[model samples]
Target: MVSVEVLNNHPTGGALCAKGRAAPEIVASPRRLTVPLKRTRPRGAADPGWVEVSWDEALTEIANRLGAIRAESGAEAVAFGVTTPSGTPMVDSFEWVERFIRGFGSPNLIYSVEICGWHKDFAHALTFGRGIGFPDYDNADAIILWGHNPARTWLAQATRIADARRRGAKVVVIDPKPNGSGQQADLWLRIRPGADGALAMGAIRHLIATGSFDADFVDAWTNGSLLVDRATGRFLRADALWPDGAADVFVRLDASGSPVPCDTRYTQQSGGRLRGVLSVRARDGRMISAATAFELLVERAAPYTPARVAELTWLPIADIEAFNALLATRPRLAYHSWTGVGQHTNATAIERTIASLYALTGACDRPGGNRWPVPPPTRALNDYNILPPEQQAKALGIAELPLGPPAKGWITARDFSRAVLEGEPYRVRALVAFGTNFVVSQGHSERNKAALNALEFQVHIDMFMNPTAESADFVLPASTPWERDALKIGFEITQAAVETVQFRPRMVEPVGEVKADYEIAAALALKLGMHELFFGGDIEAGWNYQLAPLGVGVEDLRGHPEGRRFPQAFRDEKYAVTREDGTAAGFATPTRRVEIYS
Candidate 1:
């Protein structure tokens, strides 16, 4: 391998970090797993008694055993495992791995997300009906970094934050410790761990009490004023209150303190009451007591007063107000959060609360805020529909945590280990894992190892023989990102970035008989008679399918390594986009609005 350098004038700032600079060394490292290997001994044996094997010998055995396990104990017996792409070369193969598992009819795919991107990517969907989008740093007037250290984590954002600061944007850092860019922050609060939810509630309370919130946005783009049944804690149905009202509609108290029909698409006039509980006579001859969602939110925040938050977060009232001041005054606010916020006990609550606070600012999907950067319409490859509903229902942990990862075909390490060790939810007899080092990435490492040892069969694919791979019956060599030809649809932070498409050719040859992760999955699928699902075992055909919407294929991308852009103007306030249902399409939540009470 030779030296590495960033492509000149690339959309990603044309820069490289120390890690990126070490790509050549990583590709040529002595520790690299260069060939397929088989364990001659049992999993718990002192030595695996490793022996080299051909791709056919390794993959045919894996496919045959996986099918046998499924035939004997159902598809749920064989689970898939994939490494998080954020810190690994698995980015190119993540969707492909998902496609393989779903096509194979297995509902479980174990990947550690609770400690990583779960909160930012999945938990926020509870309120917003979508994950947090790219922060529009270019036009932001106030930039809030809540437990996010872009300088150390995301160089592209660090560059954007630096440029934004240079352009006179105010900066606020809400973290317990001082990070790199915090040195220049206009306000830095050393918040107590797990108390970010408190700070968010305090901010929302301050905005509400001072009448500084975006009332129009709140009424039109959030379920804040939708009435909730006091007894059932659900949205009060209009039909329950009046004989003429429709069951599909919800009730909201208008400006005159009268109940009005509220639809899922937030198209109501901006006059809903934000506070106070009320009682109304129902058709059932019962007097129902109900409160607006905003009223409940306000009530929830009542205890999180400035003084209370100060005690809980160990920050002075002055500092707390400063934090609220930014959210109140900065109409062009942009914010980001990361692992530090997700590593706490109330991680999901913190994410939801912060999302609610941001909703009050009416900055989501708008200019100078967190805008949903539209991406290249790559036809999605992960078709879970192929996995029948009955099969999907058997996914481990789905019944217990219906809204969590299990619903999305991914399981946590804890539940996965339990399924193997105790078989409470059903035994996971076999695993086809790609690049995940769960033995170290997860908590209770020893228990995880023991569970791995108990598996009837395990196949691991990685560039190096990591701890998790060492426990597997077969360890197949996988090529690094540098040695693979990957098609990039969109970098996704801005309109320009989202419009760009690049196909990167291999930068280095594999050190030995290493195959790309997706290639390995495709080859296995061919053996498993899933040729149609994996594009007839043709990687280029799959890439072509993904590029169809762009009117470009692999051949086109191959000629444009520098990338080609499908230029289009950026659209702001996308939540208010008109829909076919003749309603102002709001957020993607069930109410088509930001959900605070969820």
Candidate 2:
């Protein structure tokens, strides 16, 4: 058992949360699985006889079974499932796992996409071409906690928020239930579930109607001036107007009420120069009235008046007005949200509208507002190109749920059950899950069980034998964080205001013969004749490869258990950098600007 000790130099003053304090008991729990177990009986047997097996034997059997299934039904038949990292560190192997699967020729991988941060990630990418980063609480004068209860969910952020409030920052909380943060909030809006989109639109309408939005930032950094055809609802391309010109160039109306080719260079310095053009006559004898993307957004949000939104969201009209008032009046306002706003069917729309709040107010990428996260320098490990296009075309849910796929082409957990049970697109004959408590973590537990039972071969890697693992054909024990040496770069919960990298040395020997998740994957990769792809089964080599871009190696972290901070400076308006052609390198979107409408 590990003992807790206080250190003066610690970031949190050596403070241990309740969960952290109980780690020893949790790790030493009787329910923890210590050995690899294989089911001896057929699928769906209530009393399936279990037999112990060595790591080598288990890995070989799993590899052979998966290989046979792939040969029979093609590699697309194999699917992978993983839970979020909140419960286990197995997700740290996500990139490597995807690499292995892509090399093995499959495109289906599942995680809690819809119920987690997928909406935030995807919607923000659509609007800003990147994920919204953490709030700059230290400099913020106003905070809006939408559907996020940081007090219970993220204590670090909660503490920072509390301190911000004590220092005169107004706190507004919007949630269905009265939470820890909500109780102390200056204003609390008790919203109805799945109505966040309406509320956000309502707030946006207020901003637009009252002329409280940051017109300068919107006109400059965003696609507010880009003209969209009224008939097609698509941006009018430069080439469409000028047949001999660049097809990718978009059009914007100048101050003199004339069409101008809006290139990347023009976008940088064209703020407030062009008016919001509602329409223009096409050169092809068509009187096409084109509206700016911002104008379209205003029209879209016009219907969500405060009263109507209050009715739809079960919020008070006064509260909605007050919330918008604070946002409009506060100079340094920051908004934050998490899973509660992302679990609904309209989660994408909701997150998009929330992102627009920051853009409309010029809060994004600004000091004391929402700052983009600086990702640690790491090599791209997901060799997604290894999978052929035809195979990738078989990924489930692309037709029905377009925004559910992440950067790595993950199949949403919401659709995993359907793909497995219905086999509408194709049959999924094999599954390799890590850290996923499928029945509990996913929606429709019965469907998940049926899908698991239907699989020709199933493997589950976890520290405990949960219901999902009991249904698997092979269950491999996983090592806990205490039993593994790892590099903790930043806090996933708080987004780490001060960026630092720390080495976590193994505190104790792993229980029984359990191995780290990466080791298991490497062993299986070797059995599948893909050892070279996995750095010849060297875990340290993989770590070094990931850190090479940062000019650090695994050995550099070995002696620095306390971690080291890189001398990086945080700057506001990071997206305002200029490109080589003297145009604005505004954002990474197609229009090279923040997308008000996609």
On the 0 to 100 scale, the lDDT of residue 505 in model 2 is 82
Q: Write the per-residue lDDT of candidate 1 for residues 62-137, one digit (tens) a residue.
A: 8899989988999899988898877678878887878888888899888867777788888998999888888899
lDDT per residue (tens digit) for residues 1-598 in model 2: 6665544343443345556667788678788888999999997787879899998889988999999988998987899887676535754666666778788888888876667877666777888988867788888989989888887776667877888999999998888878688998999899999898898898888888888888888878888788888888888888777766577888877776577787754545464332365556565877787877887888889999888998899988889888889877847887788888887777888888888877889988887888876766667667678788888777877777655673355887656777788876777888898778888777788888888888878899998888888889999998877888776555442334245667678888888988887788778888999978888988788878877877988788889777766545556787877567766657888888888888
Which runs of model 2 end up more than 4 angstroms from their true locations?
A: 5-18, 242-246, 267-279, 492-498
- Taking all chains together, each candidate's TM-score versus the true structure is 0.96, 0.94
Go through the candidates in order and give each one's C-alpha lDDT: 0.85, 0.78
The TM-score of candidate 2 is 0.94
As for candidate 2, its clashing pairs are 265-583, 279-289, 279-290
